[model samples]
Target: MKNNLTKLVKKANAGDKQSLELVILEINDLIYNLSLKMLLFPEDAKDATQEILIKVITHLSTFHYQSQFTTWVYRIATNYLITYKGKKSKEFAMPFKEYAVLIDSGQSDTVSYAKNAGELALLEEEVKVSCTQGLLLCLNSSDRLVYILAEILEFSSKEGAAILTITPDNFRKKLSRSRQKIRNFLTNKCGLVNSENPCRCHKKIDFLTHQKVINPNNLRFAQFTKRSIDLVDQIGDLEKAIAIYRATPAIPAPETIMKTIKETILIT
Candidate 1:
C-alpha cells in the first residue's frame, strides 16, 4: 500500500492521468467514509467528500514528505469538517430526542411499518444508525472528530494527533473526554448497551413507524449487501457503548462522487 501510494504520488505529480485516477479510486473510500460519519447525511457526505478530494488533489504539491500521504490527506479532510457549518437534514422528521420523549410517554400511537419480523429487524438496525448518528451531532465538532478518529476509525493517538495537528497527549485527552461523554449518553439512553435504559429499538419501532422516521419499504442505513459494523472482536478496555458505536457499519461511498472525481482528474 505504501509503495503504491508513493508511485501514485510521483506519477500524479507528473500529471499522469491513469495514476491520478488510481489515486482517486484508492483514497475515495477513506475520505467518503469519514465524510458520511461526520456529516451524518448521504448527500452532505457526498458533497463534502468531493470538496475534500478536490482540495487534496489541488494541494498535493504542497504536501511535504514528513508525514504519510494518508495522514496528510486526513489532515485536509479533518480540518474541512472542523470548520464546516452546513446543516444536514435529519434522518427522521422528528428529532430522535423527541422520539425518545414520546417513547417515555404512554401517548404514542402504535403502528407497524414493517410487514414481517425480518423486515422489522432490518428497520431496527437502521434505527440504531439514526440514533447513534444523532448522538454524534450533540457533541461539538472537535470532540466528535476525536471520538470518531480514535474510537471508530481506530487511529492511533499519534496518527490522530498528526491528522488534527495536535500533540498526541492532547489527542488522548480529548479522546478520553469524548469517550466519557458518549458513554454517558448511550448508557442513559441506549437500551441495547444498557438493559436498564428505557429506550429500546423494538419499543421505538412503532413510534418511528408512525412518525415516518423509518419506512419499512425504504430502508436507508440497513442494506442487504453489507453487514453491520461489528467491533465485538476488537473490544478493548474502552466503554462497551463506544465499542458498539465503533462497530456500526460505515456507509459506502456513492458511485456518483467517484465518477465525478475520475472525470475531474482526467480533465485536469
Candidate 2:
C-alpha cells in the first residue's frame, strides 16, 4: 500500500487530478472514518477529511519520502482534527446563532427547478452527517480530541500524542482529567455511573473519582470505573472533584454538529 501510495503521490504532485482523487479515494476511509469516530459528528468528520485532503494536495510537492506516505497523511489528518475541534469548542462554549442564521440564504427550490433523486440523497447524507457534529458537544475540544483518539478510536496514548503534538504523558494526564469531567457530567444527568446503585449518597459520589488513568493491561476500555473511583477516594482524604461538581450543577444548552460537518467536508 505504501509503495502504491508513493507512486500515487508522485503522480499527484505532477498535477494529475485523477491520481490525486484516486489517492484520496483510497485513503478516504482511514481519513474520514477516524475523524467521524473521533468527532462523533459526520459534518466535522467531513470537514476534517476535506481540510486534510486540501493540505495533502497543496503540499504534495513538499512530501519527503522518508516515512510511509500513509504516516504523513495520518499526521495531516490529526492536525486538522485538532484545529477543527478547537474552533468548534469555541463555538460550542459560546454559540453565535444569530450570526449563523444570517448566513443561510434559503434552501434551493428543488421542486420548482425540477427535482432529482441525487439531490434528495444529498440531503439525506447531510442529515446523517449532522450526528457526527453533535457527538462531541459534551466535551471541550482538548478532551474531545483525546477521547476521539484514545477512547473511541482506540489509538494508544503514544500514537494519540503524536497526532496531537503532545507528549504521551501529558496526553494521558489530560485524558484522565477530561474523562473525569465527562463521566461526572453523565452520572449527574443520566445516572449512568458504574456504581451498583444510583441512590448512593452524594458523600459516596464525592469520595469516588471522575476519570482514572488506564493501566498498562487495561487501556482497551474507555471507562475504568474502579481505578478512577479509588483515585478519588485517595484524593478526597479531605474532599474530591466529583463532590465539588455535584455541589453545583453546570448551566445548560448546546451546539449544532451538522453545520460543523458540512463546513468540514465542503470546506467553503
Candidate 3:
C-alpha cells in the first residue's frame, strides 16, 4: 500500500489529476480520523481534514520522498492540529484535575430514555466514544498528539518522534507521561477501566440524551455496522484505558467532504 501511495505521489507531483484524486481518496479517512481524535468534534474534524488535505495537495511537490509518505502527511496533520484554535479546543481547555472534577459532578443514575435494549446499546456506545474523546482534550496539545500517535495509533516512538520532529527519547517520555495521566484518570473515574468506578456509559446515557449532547438519530462516533466490543476484541492485551482508545474505530470521512476536497484540488 505504501509503495502504491509512493507511485501515486510521483504521478501526482507530475501533474496527473487522477493520481492526485487517488492520493486524496487513499488518505482522506486517516486524516479525518486523526482530526476527529485531535479536535474531538466531527464537524471541526471535517473542516480540519479539508484544510489538511489542501495543505497536503498544495505541498505535494515539496515531499522529496525522504520519509514515509504517511509520515509526511502525519507531520502536516499534527502541525495543524497542534496550532488549531478550534471551538472544541477552547471549550475543552482545562487540566485533568478540573476535568476529573467535572466528571465527578455528573449524575450517574439518571433515567435513560432509550426505548429498548438496542437503543440503550447505541446510547452507551455514543457516551463511551464521547467520554473517551473528552479525556484526550484534557491533555495539552503536544501531549495529546503524542498519546494519540503512540498509544492509540500505535506508532513506534521513533516514528512518532520523526513525525513530531522531537527526539525518540522525548517522544517516549511524553507518551509515558500522557499515558499515565489518562490511565490514572480512567482507573479512578471510568467504569470501563475499573468496574469499581461509578461512571458507567449506560448511566450517563440519559443525561447526554436529555441534554442533546448525543442525538439518537445522528450518532457522531458509533458505527452501526460494528459495536465497540467488536473493536475491543481486536485489540490485544494492553492497559485497559489505552485499549479503549486503541479500540476506537477509524471515523470515515463524509463523502461530501471528499467531494469538496477533490474539487478544491482540481481548482488548485
lDDT of 2 by residue, 32-124 (tens): 666654554344556666666667667778888876677677778776766576344344332223322211223223222114654333332
Instruction: Mark the 10 consecutive residues where model 1 has the least summed lDDT.
Output: 224-233
Q: In candidate 1, what are the lDDT values of residues 57-107, reduced to their tens digit?
A: 889888767778888899999999887755563343244366446546533
- lDDT per model vs. reference: 0.75, 0.49, 0.85
Candidate 1 TM-score, C-alpha based? 0.87
**Candidate 3 lDDT over residue span 1-268, tens digit each:** 9999999999999989999999999999999989988888888888999999999999999999999899999999999999896786577667888878766765666555777878777778888888888889888899999999998898999999999999999999999899889989999998888889888888877677776667888988776325684465456777688878877768789998888986676765
Candidate 3 yields a Cα-based lDDT of: 0.85
TM-score of 3: 0.94
Better of 2 and 3 by lDDT: 3
Clashing pairs in 3: none
Largest lDDT belongs to which candidate?
Answer: 3
Candidate 3's C-alpha runs over 4 A off are: 229-236
- In model 2, the worst 10-residue window by lDDT is 205-214
Q: Clashes per prediction?
A: 2, 11, 0
- RMSD score of candidate 1 (Å): 3.2
